[model samples]
Target: MANYLLIAASSDIGGATARRLRDGGHHVITTARDASVIDPDVVLDATDFDAVDRVVAEAGDLDGIAVFAGSMLLKPAHLISRAQYDETIAASLTTSFAVVRAAGKHLRNGGSVVLSSSAVALAGLSNHDAIAAAKAGVIGLALSAAASYASHGLRVNAVAPGLVQTRLTEGLTSSDMSRKVSEAMHPLGRLGEPEDIARAVEFLLDPANDWITGQVLGVDGGLGALRPRQRV
Candidate 1:
């Protein structure tokens, strides 16, 4: 069985991805900021480069790495404080950067790397300025890393999800009215499930799909690409 490292395995996407990878007969090593009920194999903050590198080194060589560590901030651009803005970037964009950097140095040649982006990066939405900017940075980072690692046969890609029902978005989906609005915003008429994003990550990490790289796969429920019918 091939070995893989999943950073932020405590999150919804991370937890689901771990189960999927393990059930596929692969060895999965998980990391999170703390060892809570999720029971991560390793506990380290993804934003800390030294901590990330140390844990990755200890995981030994990995066939692939999936970085699913991030948080969501839902507020008007004017309402968000400067400190909160920095926190958003640290949690979402910087964390992804750290994972890719560590993976670049430690992953076995020809290994694949997958990171998370968001549907907001592709389509504009009110109160998503902070997150949209961060996810957009993730896309750029993944593409550049893909080029830098291409000579080593290493592949890098990203998955941009739309309104997934995870802890990160519970606030937005908790109420019936809000949930309905969210569902309506997507062409699929529903918010995404953690498994939806997990499956996309699984596909990108598969060695059989080695020919694919440097691509951002939108796993959103057509929220980023489609428009609802309007009376003409």
Candidate 2:
């Protein structure tokens, strides 16, 4: 079994990933900001670099680390408040940077690191300006970290997922009409499930995929590559 550390384990994707890894005979150490909702091995905000370092120090000899911390804010660029922008960036890009930096320093040689991105970052979508920018920053962080740590045999990569059906997206997909619209927006004609992204994350975390590094694998249900079908 391989040892792994997961930051922000309270999210739907993080929880699903933890279960998948554990079921695969891997040991996972989880961290969460809210200890009440999800009991984690470590209770610390990943946005704090010092806290990330402390958690990784305690997680010792980890083979992989995945940062699943992120926030979704659907607002036009002109309407996004300063507070909203700050919060979104802190939740997405800032936390990602902290996790990747700490992992580069703490993870054992030949270990892997996985960060989260979004399909909106790769392809523009309406009212997603704030989130798109932040997630794009995550892609940059992953690529830079991968280059910085490659000599040590460490690999860093990212997963860019489309509209996954999770608590994070419940507000956008709760109603029947809204759900239909979301599904139609994807070329697959269905919204992505948390498990789908979880599986992609697992692949990157697997030590056997050591050759893959500095790549942003899109697990976006073909949304990133194909446009939505045109109405007749």
Candidate 3:
């Protein structure tokens, strides 16, 4: 059983990943901003570098760490306010950097670090400027960190998921028209579930798959790489 830390466990994807890891007999230490919700081992604002360091310090001899802290902002670049853009970056890219920094200092050699990116980062989608930029940064960070940590046998990778059905996407999925549009965008003809992304994360975290590093696994139901077939 490997010891792992999951930041922002209150989020749907985070919770699912934590559960999946635990079910596989791994010891998962979870953290979230709200302690009342998921009862995580730590109540953390993942964007805070110092707080992230503290959590990493406490999780001794971890085999892996996954940062599931992120935000979704569907707005055109021209329409997005400075505050919204900053918040989006802080929630995703900044939080991811915090995890990377903490893991670099405290994680055991040969450990894994998995970060959350988005399909929008790989595929150009309308009204996704803020989130796309932030997630793209996550990809860059993961690749560079992977290179830096390779000598130590550490692996750094990311999962770029399509629109998964979660609270963060309730506004889009709850509406029939919006949901249909989103479903059609993915060649798979449906939206992704939290489990989809969780499985990818679990795959990247598995020590058996240690050969993989610096790659962005797209758990996006083909959204990032495929176009839907035209109906006759």
Candidate 4:
């Protein structure tokens, strides 16, 4: 079975992804700042530079890497200060960069890296300035990052999820109006589940997917494609 390095293992998406990999019999070394949030064999936050290095050091020769580290704080453009934007970038975008850099030495040749993005990167949304910017950078970083690691037969790609059911979206769960709005936003008439994105992550991480690199797959319940259009 393949081994995986799962950053943000404590997050709902990260945890679900990790569980999927584990249940499929792949070994996984997972990490998050709070050990209490994850039952992983190891715990470290990607945002913590030195701790992240240590975690990678301990988990050697991984077959794949899944970066699910992220945060969400919606606010009007005018209300989003530079410092807040930087924080979101650091947590959602910068952390992935650092994890990739750390994993390079341990990621086996021909292995893949999956970075998380959001459908917001392409679809317009209110109060999504910071996250959209960061996720967009993730899409941009994919090809360049793939280029840097191609010598080692490494592939990099990003997944842009839309309205997935997760802790990050717990607030929306309680609001029927919000849920209805979300459902209507996707032509599928439903929100994305964690498994939807998790399955996509699995495909991108599969070694057989060598030909598919430096791409962004939108696992957004048709939000990016069918949104802005009424479906009959």
Model 4 lDDT per residue over 102-183, tens place: 7666665568989998899888888888888888888888868888888888888999999988888888766999899878
lDDT of 1 by residue, 3-49 (tens): 89998889999999999999999999998888875888888889998
Clashing pairs in 3: none
lDDT of each: 0.89, 0.91, 0.92, 0.83
Deviation of model 2 at 192, angstroms: 0.8
Error of 1 at 203 (Å): 0.6
lDDT ranking from best candidate downward: 3, 2, 1, 4
| Cα-based lDDT at residue 42, candidate 3 | 83
- Number of the top-ranking candidate, with lDDT as the measure: 3
lDDT of 3 by residue, 202-222 (tens): 999999999999999999989
Instruction: Give model 1's TM-score versus the native structure.
Output: 0.96
Error of 3 at 121 (Å): 0.4
1-232 per-residue lDDT for model 2 (tens digits): 9999999989999999999999999999999997986989888888999989888888889999999989988889999999999999999899989888788788757799899999999887999999999999999999998999999999999999989999889998999999999888888788999899999999999988889999999998787778765765
Return the TM-score for each candidate structure: 0.96, 0.97, 0.97, 0.93
Q: Model 4: which residue pairs collide?
A: none
